[model samples]
Target: LWSSIIKSKNKTYYLGYFWDKETAAQVVRIKRLELHGEFANHG
Candidate 1:
């Protein structure tokens, strides 16, 4: 299995463990939105 990971401020976060890269990328997008907050980019 392959894993998706994101690191920030000396911390490591997992997006997910997936069988393929495509799924991992999708998970990363969703997780990024959650971590960054949905309204963060709203003007």
Candidate 2:
């Protein structure tokens, strides 16, 4: 699992902090799927 929390200027941003290869891969896969879905829906 990847997770990160950053606070700056009262704004918080969470960044990837992958713990393992599998987790990183899963994140990438999910992101790709989401992008694909968005493109399919819009195009």
Question: Residues 1-43, candidate 1, lDDT per residue (tens digit)?
Answer: 8799976558899766999888887777776677777643312
lDDT of 2 by residue, 1-43 (tens): 5564444447665548787767665655565455455553321
Report clash pairs, candidate 1.
none
C-alpha lDDT values of all predictions: 0.74, 0.54
- Which pairs clash in the backbone of model 2? none
Q: Clashes in each model (backbone N, CA, C under 3 Å)? A: 0, 0
Best by TM-score, which number? 1
Candidate 2: how large is its RMSD?
A: 7.9
